[model samples]
Target chain A: MPGVENCLQEAMAIPGAIGASIVDYTTGFPVATTGAAPNEDHEAAAAGTADVVQAAQSRSLFVSAVPHDLLEDLIITTAGGYHLLRLVRTDFDSRLVLYVWLDRLRGNLAVARRRMQTLADELTTR
Target chain B: MPPAVAPSRLLKQAADDGRTGALLVGGAPGGTVYLVRGAVTYAESAAAPGVGELLTVSGRLAARTWEAALEAGAGRGAVGHLLYEQGHLTQGELELCVLGATYDAAYFALGRPDAPAEFRDDVRHWLGDVVRIDPGALTRESRRRTKLVEDIFPQPGLDTAPVIPVTRAPRERVSMTAAQWELLVHADGQRTPADLAQLLGRAGYATVLELRRMAALGLIEAPPPATPDNPDFVRLPRAHGEAVNRVRPAVPAASEAPTVPIVPSGASPPAPAPAAVAVVPAQVTVASAPEAPARPPKLARRKPGARLPKEIAAEPPEPHPGADEVLLKRIRTALRALR
Candidate 1:
């Protein structure tokens, strides 16, 4: 029963988490954000995350041949951090994405990914 | 750079003073921006769909449920909390929906360049403060979205004009976003982006942006020209490399002349004169031609206010067929006051 702000707060609690945000990929609007972000701008980080997500979702080549297959999470690892995006599924057209930026040194990528999946589900489920 | 004296300066001033209330922006498609102790909590525009419209239209909540929640909590400005507590929708769904709706409306509400804004102290939105946006951040996002739309398609005229799909596709293969596909299916050559937004319960700015993208891809009709003769004419996008000159030249003249009856004779003289109509043959020629010089006579004949009448009446008699009349009437009254 976590709300948007609560879910964002939970994401910030992840090990070595630098920033977290809920983004609507359709319009690239950040629903809520917490902690540090790239270039110190959460808005830009959210917009960039949306562009990446949209690129992955729209391209025919990126889509699997399996019917009804959906993209779950996207991970982009840089030298200093890991950018993880987990799609939030809903009954209607799904548009929300949970984005987390974790310090590569202190954050366990596997733990962070698993926790984010749970957070996304908790945020959506009543 | 932004102007030193924009209407949004009112928002900046309120934010600086840490005031809790609503700011009413007055003009065409005007809206109110709700702030809580200086942070923007919500915004709604006559041009975009509101949170209630989004929820009910998306089937996330029943119309009856939304009405019941509003009846119970609107006066206290706690509809968001009430719905969540009542188990009508999840907390996350309500927050995300409000945030999305607020940003969408803010694009039209706070982004206005010339609209005058007034702040009333101690007002609050029915949904309460589910999300708080920095005034500066909201303004920056609005500017970025505006620039993005221009970059996607420079034709601002197409935003309000009717979304008319081309008679045929210009390319053998075409691709479109799901939103664009929805727009194409709903477009009836009469519903402008704003009208379609209300009808489909989608954000107005998003609809405009998608229609502009479709125009750039040659998927929809080019916007009606600014000429007085064809004031309401919606030109279908022509097939690429088609016979540009050989098709029925009088077809445009015939269609353009009779569709609208509001055009004054002196203003739209091109309607009667076949010679004037010939210059605007195939909108693409006017589109593909080197920008300004190709249609010199047509451009020069245009009067400043000749198109006003048509634009004012462009919307259908009933803009929101599915929405409750009382709510819409209140909005209409507010919009009329601002206008």
Candidate 2:
């Protein structure tokens, strides 16, 4: 089965992609690296994005009305680029996030989001 | 000068030599790092709770079962195997528990500056190693875990201090995970995180991670002191009591109504109009919970001597965008104008 490296390769193949990484959210380090790391260290980026993921997730837990909402995907649109973070569930306790940075002008956000989801499902250890 | 030897190299040498033994690392406060033919099969450390403890303390595996394993282990070992075969735990669970515990122990054992490593050849653990990990990989993974905790939640003693749940309700309602709910019940502002970890039989790291998340949500406060002189004194009462008094339309503390007028101080945003506006009792989800009748809107009870603001601070409370309170205020002003 395709693993961390395979996941990163498929992610880098996305159109307009700059760099793709599979980061262990707990450590904020990319488990496997391909091409160049992001503008900032991918590990640091993972750490920052993890804060966002955890904060967003806290919302679903802090209310009784809403059912448990897992953060499936996130897209950040910046002036320079599009950043996508996908939460990849695993059989183990360790959490992983698949991140791809794409050129905003050239990349399609919808397509990127869909592709990342599929990669995450495949990357998950069954 | 000769070059220094790497930890991984020592492990490689052991495998190359076909060594079958426990590489005893440290004593008392330290742990043992085990190697079987150059592979890291098992590890033990004083820094973490044991795999046996982690499983049994969780109340999943009883003491008698562990005792049985030990008794059977004397002549023919693999206590873990015996327990699993007896259906005390599944194969997957046994492996995960041992793996997690071993990794946790190795993290502390390898990083110990005070405890020096000592090797003893031709030795084995009673339960034995569950899986073999590469020495280099183990070092890298352990370091990554330590750094991750330091980088993300750097508050010193965040894990060592007692957890006190926030008393004042910041939001109208709160939610928690199943794990969080169990931890919250045991918080009690007494047991430190590690103590709670052992009590719950959860990994020490996992417990701390949840506590950090809880801190982010303002559900719990990381105590300023390791041993607070007066534990309850740490934010004993909510400081927002004054704000609650100003904003609440009619939050009745006791049965008797307050004499203050409906006009609220400008500093405070208006509280949600009484539950009468919307029947929001406690936001509890369980149908089995005894249903409480919706409480009327809580009114602000001013201090006995506090006087009302002369101008009645007329601008909408902080201009909350598209709020029902804003709409309600505009309607109230229009009615008064008609007068």
Q: Pick the candidate with the highest TM-score.
A: 1
lDDT, candidate 1, B283-309, per-residue tens: 635554454233323323334554544
Sliding window of 10 residues with minimal summed lDDT for model 1 chain B:
B232-241
How high is the TM-score of chain A in each model?
Answer: 0.95, 0.85
Model 2 residue B277 distance off true place after TM-score fit, in angstroms: 86
Interface RMSD of each: 2.3, 7.2
TM-score, model 2 to reference:
0.47
Reference-based lDDT, each prediction: 0.75, 0.59
Lowest summed lDDT window (length 10), candidate 2 chain B: B313-322
- Candidate 2 wrongly placed segments (more than 4 Å): A59-65, A103-106, B1-106, B119-180, B186-203, B212-339
* DockQ of candidate 1 (2 decimals): 0.43
Encode model 2's per-residue lDDT on B225-248: one tens digit a residue.
523222222232243344443333
